[model samples]
Target: MFDSFVFMAPPLPDDLVTRYFRHCLEDSLFTLRRQVRMARMSGRFGANDETRLSLMPMILQSLLEDGIRDRLPLQRVDPEWSPETLVIAMHLYSVEARRIQSPEETRRIQQTFPDIKTPDFTSAEHTGQLREAYIAARLAALRDGTTPTSLSIGIEL
Candidate 1:
């Protein structure tokens, strides 16, 4: 069932993709803030979450409007892609864009979250890896009878 959706979905328009990216960025920040607030209530808010909270605004600011339209590779939002896939791709692109637009902020983020991976949009290999990872995650989510949430994208606070 999910495989059929993956195989038959049409490519999303460039404008729609850009809109999705913007929505994802806003949604991610809102979700993170709520999580951080809850964690604070529980005395579970930690250094890593603090670091992410601080850096997320910078990254989000850099990727707004023209920044997103200019940085995003529309081609990578494949015809087989779901909204979840676009969320993952946009998240990766956001990281790469931040790295290019604000190296210092990117460095701060990397220092805090050493395991977070960003793709080199110029490299086919890197983009291919991203595509493969998205497919695997989507398939796994389907098999588990769950939908992938945009918040699961690694950069979430």
Candidate 2:
């Protein structure tokens, strides 16, 4: 599910970052869950953790800038809102959302939302939309000053 496309030559760091961002943005909830689980199971973030860490902030910043250029409502309307902050918030939110959950908590969540069908991550098309909604809710909370940080992970965004 996380296959990289071939290119003419060695892809630039920026190219890799762009691809990663796009992959995250386009991933299904199930895919995200699987990815998060696999990462945790590996017991290390990645062999290239240092490289990824260095590139992620820049990638996120660029993605946010692109969003701004496209006139997407990525940031709160409040004048005090910072695009950089919003980018970080969005990145963290996405990461945590897909983080592995305890079996007990997963069962509890399943019980709590019995009516909502579990999303199929393999082929679902609206995961990006769902993720964007999560981001939007975080932005709304900030805009309203209802929450100090954006959101708590397990609340069913």
Candidate 3:
């Protein structure tokens, strides 16, 4: 039933969409940076850590912000992409950078860096699910003429 439910809601205004996406992107970047830092401090940082850390800000400022402002679909910005794809990409990159080999390692990392959250879903199927949930929540908020306090982008496994 949940999978079949669909709301025929109008698109949010460009300005509002841009602002919302910008906020989400900023928060994601901040969290990623914090995770990178924590990993470095814990001596679990990956070999390519410096490159990923350096490139993230550039991606945010150049690619993400521009795409958000233009109201471009993720595919238009980059093929086979979505907002959730970006989130998943960042999470996976962080995981790789931290050299997390298994669930056990992830748990240990979380234990050490309580603030860092490894997403439960990184598979393509989960990415689509997350994207759907995010859009649904955003559309509901727009329909009600209120900004959502938080977007539902990461459903727990």
Candidate 4:
């Protein structure tokens, strides 16, 4: 069942895909939701890797198109906002999401990449709250005249 949902990228409308990303972020199932997010951004999957392509990248790409058409909030906050910035944010969120959802896998990942910093999601009660905090922090930094780096919204929250 989980495999079906993760592997099949239906021909969902752009709006629906965007909505699905939000739902996935809020989903309680760690194995599916967090894994999909992490896998999508892990850079191991090529553009043609449909079996590995999860919903996060699809929706994020769609969001970038929408942002180009209708100016995303990050754009208003910082005129230099690009899709790469959003992708980086997604990657950070995925790292934290995987940590919160799958501790064992996260530990293995940490051991694999010793220098990589992972967020402390041990106490988080909701993934959405953490995502909101990240976005809020980025926006705050941008509004304060600080050039919001890809990691300006660190995993502090």
Reference-based TM-score of each model: 0.28, 0.25, 0.30, 0.19
Those runs of model 3 whose alpha carbons end farther than 4 Å from true positions after fitting are 1-8, 48-157
Backbone clashes in model 4, listed as residue pairs: none
Q: Taking the tens digit of each residue's C-alpha lDDT, what string does model 1 give over 30-145? A: 55445655787799877655544443333334343234444455544457756655565567566656454365643432232223334312333333233323223322332332
Per-residue lDDT value at 100 in model 1: 44
Model 2 over residues 1-157: C-alpha lDDT tens digits?
A: 2333232223223443344334433333334445545665688765344343443343334333343223223443335536655455455535434431334534433333222344422221223333333334323323333122233234544
Candidate 2 wrong stretches, greater than 4 Å:
1-115, 119-124, 146-157
Give the RMSD in angstroms, all C-alphas superposed, for model 4: 17.1
The local lDDT score (0 to 100) that residue 92 gets in candidate 2 is 51
The top-ranked prediction according to TM-score is 3
TM-score, structure 4 vs. true: 0.19
| Local error of candidate 1 at residue 18 (angstroms) | 2.6
Q: Give the higher-lDDT candidate: 1 or 3.
A: 1
Query: What are the lDDT scores of the predictions, listed in order?
Result: 0.43, 0.37, 0.40, 0.37
> Which of the numbered candidates is closest to the native, going by highest lDDT?
1
The superposed Cα distance between candidate 4 and the true structure at residue 101, in angstroms, equals 14
Candidate 3, residue 108: the lDDT equals: 42
Clashing pairs in 2: none
